[model samples]
Target: MTAPESGDVWSFDYLWRWQHERGETEGRKPRPTALVACVKGANGRTNLFILPITKTRPSDDRLAVEIPQIERVRAGLAADLRLWVMIDEYNHDFLETSFYLDPKGRIGRFSSAFHKAVLAAFVQAGREKRLRKVPRYD
Candidate 1:
């Protein structure tokens, strides 16, 4: 399989805020996670920045982007359900050696426009000091 690209949604064992705070390194369950960025380090290791997608509505304190129906279909998500991409926080993992990311296969890719919007939102959150990075790799 080729290396993962931005906007590729995968079923990943995502660790939540509560879980991460309690010193838990493992995620509770597998969920749809969108690959927002892929950066290659000097050692040739790819660091994947992924955001979790959920049907749950974001709280006032959380910053998220609502997934359009067409975008949901493009990403191979359930079009019937209202989905939101949490941009205020993300999980960072290594594409090459992640125990959390198996070679099962990705759901699909989001449209370039939607994917760019997600990235923009994430950056804004970061600049506002609202972005949380949940490290999935030690």
Candidate 2:
């Protein structure tokens, strides 16, 4: 199982290519960011991040394509991520627009309350593990 290059944003096609070459079964889901937990990708559930090739890199210093969203949200390391079932309501509008961590530290993306719940659950689980301690974002 090959992991994406650190600090690099990956396009859908590129990610699919990697999956194909590696015989992975994790398909692209309708999420704002292209990270998912697959029952058959590397592990049962893995932290994978993907961004389109067009807006891959936004930082002037970094020439590589990396999503600034990840940095803002303070997601835990791969070993610290929690796997939660993605409900249809939570998935709505997730892929249509980009998400950001607001000044209040709450997830600011889609307008779906369900999605917010899912993200909150993930954060809570990670906190319990103490693997990734994001500052209070209540």
Compare the candidates by TM-score and give the number of the best one.
Answer: 1
- The local distance difference test score of each candidate is 0.90, 0.29
Error of 2 at 48 (Å): 4.7
Residue 66 displacement (Å), model 1? 0.3
Task: Please provide, for model 1 over 99-128, each residue's C-alpha lDDT reduced to its tens digit, 9 standing for 90 to 100.
Answer: 888687588999999999999998899999
**Candidate 2 — which residues are off by over 4 angstroms?**
1-111, 130-138
Highest-lDDT candidate: 1
Candidate 2 scores a C-alpha RMSD against the true structure in Å of: 17.6
Q: Mind giving the per-residue lDDT tens digits that candidate 2 earns over 46-98?
A: 33333222222234422222323443244321223332232111111122122
Model 1 alpha-carbon miss at residue 135, Å = 1.0
